[model samples]
Target: MSLHPRRTGWRFQWVTILWLTAVWVLLWGDVSWGNVVNGALLGVLVTTGLRMTPVDFHGRVHPAALAVLLGRFALDLVRASFEVSLVALRPRYTPRGAVICVQLRSHSDLYLTLTAELVSLVPGSIIVEAHRLTGRLYVHVLDVETSGGIEKARQNVLDQEARVLRALGSDAELAEAGLSRSRRAREVAAR
Candidate 1:
């Protein structure tokens, strides 16, 4: 079955709508009902007005892993914020910047995009470019020291991808990425 079926009447895509609405709310930096309603309206308008590519997805949600992903994300946000602030405040230190390409384990565009977005949200790093076919993301780090090291930075992106896949990928999808339904598997995949 297709991820989204072709409908003749309403042609509504609920997943796309929710994704777009979430983006809209995040962009607005608010979680109010007004923002939600407006975002949903805009989401509907965009989906109806333009053509969208169908994303392939047949995965079950892992609530425990999903919760871990979100909780780690919040902690990372705060930590990155503080570290970036320190770098900015230090007048004697010169930041070493580098653009590194990270090859992701998952070939799916969905995981690649999710990892890129999540990585970009944290301070000191931005996604420079993403190759859809290659599953590689070119990321610019404001300071190598601030973000540990080049290798660590690359691992960080991969770890983020692992978190995303563990949260939303099915057993088959996980196995495809060399991940299994075990703590050891998650640990190994994150590295």
Candidate 2:
């Protein structure tokens, strides 16, 4: 009987255990009862021994809004990729990078962090720091002018936060972010 030991991750995650078992079985080249059971035991030991705090998610998902958020993220990714490439290809052009601080409208730290992560995924900008107490994020832009200057970059981060709120925010959460659910979204979710 052999088991694949897994590292500690988030708290009491069932998916982690299942994934560890699957990886163990895959590595062994044959699925057997010993491997499965042993793998689960190892997963349990690791997860229980070292636990991380779980994210607090208090919102019902709006499917349409979620789709919109994902679609926009993809588009932004592609657009940013090209922009970064163009800047790199220009030999004579000197890019000015700047760190811009943005205050998030969302009251929840979850959305604030999520917004930061999403913006970082796009090219030309990365999250430098997130201040949860003040609900602010400091992002470093690769090229300020390429990203349409400081104020525009700041607006982009705020827009990203709005997208996050629209996707997974409750009514109260939306209001707290200074955003209102679209009439269409409200109608669709009502059903």
Candidate 3:
């Protein structure tokens, strides 16, 4: 099934309305007629604010995939927290800080942003820059135990990308293209 859809202004309006109402209910915890009107107005203002900001391509995504991706991210965050904490507590540790380049397969800006944000939130790594033209991410890591440290970090990013691609229902070509590009970039950098 084709997930992509042509979104209209009305759709955006409805989305904004629904989102605002939900937020209001959550915040106030009591829904009354007054709250309903206020929430709707707030939604409109929020939508207007959003409209003023320019965003890149907004693509339709598979719901199942998105759910899976979110779940995986949650799990990864928990695991990363533990790992980072352990690394931090070790007083006699020699941290090998290195900037690793990660190649992303999916061209979606949302996916890229999500990946970057998620990785950066983790303790040991931070995404310093993302090259739009190359779809490559430069990540600064807190620890590196040799030259392979960069490669390991790159692999972690690639793994996250793979999960995102799967969630988006991307084909093998797209996945392979991203991995190939990343590998090639790393090879060139190494040489």
Candidate 4:
């Protein structure tokens, strides 16, 4: 009943072999027939000993969205650095700090991890904790000017999540659905 060949095992074995060969070439930089043979043997041995893990391939992501996210992150880094420098130079002028919670709409663990990493990389904010159950992120911010500070931080997280969703090729309907779910959850929690 199956049209595909039973080649999964062979494919994995070959991957292991290729990986070992590449590693050998990098480590020694000597391209000889002996080295190639040895590397191939080593690869087969190692790959066989190691367990194979399945790869998760979702829909194709847009390269342009990724570029945009990278650019925005770089710009934010520069701007945050300047702000942090000013804060450090004048400690007295630094506003009071507070922690803000951001609820993520995306269900992907990778996206959540990336967003947390990006937020933590900024100058004045740090990710305190991520709730595994709800995908809510708690971030501690260095400067807090007014009551709106928390809301501002929440907005920044949402904006970053939107960019990631776009990069992952999610349609407008999915995006709206995620936003609605997140909003409803927040409201329920508040009540």
Candidate 5:
């Protein structure tokens, strides 16, 4: 009857706890002291029971890359909200929705999970399913009327992965994700 979880080289699951707490806070729509305390407690309890086999991560965090990803996410969120609103409100307009399957460049389970969650968090798209073995994401996207639109959506996912890799992926992981350091620098410069 061990009280603590078996060691996984990591002392604490702060990331899981914090992410769960944030979700709890957002779902409750309140950030009061009481709510926060309850959320944190719930986060701890939930994370304790839902332990996963930790995978090796050789990633390094880059503050600039994180900032850029956040900025881009914010802008995309706003734009997508407007687009969805328009599609819903307009009478004559029909959004071309499709289930797009995108093969991820990063085969790591962590990267795939992060990319899927982040993409689904934004409006106008949702990850309907994910194939772990194939590293493919089946996302239902709005306004995907043409083949070009589908390709654009796929590219968007790839770009999102690239941005994430730039922020927190190791050198090997970045290369696996098909984003070279020079390409990353070029992307930043283009922005």
Candidate 6:
């Protein structure tokens, strides 16, 4: 099934409307009825008048996979926080960091953007730059002691991608993303 379906009748972009309304309220520093009405109108106008080509998406949402991904993220978040704290607390601690490149499997702009944002949000690493055409991300990692560290970082990116795909991608997307046979097998085992 297609991700963005055509509207039949008076169907509108409710998500866009809500997002614009939220932004408007934040910008105005108030949440009045007038502000909401204006924001809704603005959203309608922008979405309809300034129309951009809709993104083509074919991924399916798997709730179980999403739950697992969220659980892993929470654990990683805590672990990273501690690791960063340890580095910060140490005296004369110089960060052993390097810019590591990770190539993404999926070419979807949505996946690329979400993955970059999610990776950057995690402590100890940040996306320095992303190549739109190549779907590659140069991430600045906190530690890269040796070749092994680079491999670890690369594997971490792959793992993150796999989890994200499982959470939000269809089986076809999973294959398209080129996840390892072992990882792919695990998904079946999970079901």
Clashes of each: 0, 0, 1, 0, 0, 0
> Which wins on lDDT, candidate 3 or candidate 6?
6
| Candidate 2, lDDT over the whole model | 0.86
Off by over 4 Å in 1: 2-45, 184-191
The total of clashing pairs for model 3 equals 1
Question: For residues 1-191, what per-residue lDDT tens digits would candidate 4 score against the true structure?
Answer: 12232334576557667988988877788998888888888887766665544332243577877788889999989988987777778846747899889888865666677789988998888999998678899989887653247788788887887766666634553445354224465587579
Lowest-lDDT window of 10 residues in candidate 6?
Answer: 1-10
The collision pairs in model 2 are: none
lDDT (0 to 1) per candidate: 0.89, 0.86, 0.70, 0.72, 0.81, 0.78
Decoy 2 TM-score against native: 0.76
- Candidate 3 residue lDDT tens string, 76-169: 7787687777777889987768887887876666668877887888667899998867788899987775324677778888877766655553
Looking at model 3, the pairs that clash are: 96-144
How do the residues 83-145 of candidate 5 rate in per-residue lDDT, one tens digit apiece? Answer: 788778989887778998999998888888989998999888999999989999999997775
User: Clash pairs of candidate 1?
Assistant: none
Clashes of 5: 0
Q: Which ten residues in a row have the lowest lDDT in candidate 3?
A: 1-10
Q: Write the per-residue lDDT of candidate 2 for residues 1-191, one digit (tens) a residue.
A: 11222332344268777888888888888889999998888877766776545555679789998999999999999999999999999999999999999999986878988898999999999999999999999999999988999999999999899989989999898877667789677577679
Residue 25 of model 4, lDDT score? 71
Top candidate by lDDT: 1
- The number of the candidate with the highest TM-score is 1
lDDT of 1: 0.89
Best of the two (1, 5) by lDDT: 1
Ranking by lDDT: 1, 2, 5, 6, 4, 3
Candidates 3 and 5 compared by TM-score, better number: 5
Q: What are the root-mean-square deviations of the candidates from the true structure over C-alphas? A: 4.2, 7.1, 7.4, 8.3, 4.8, 4.3
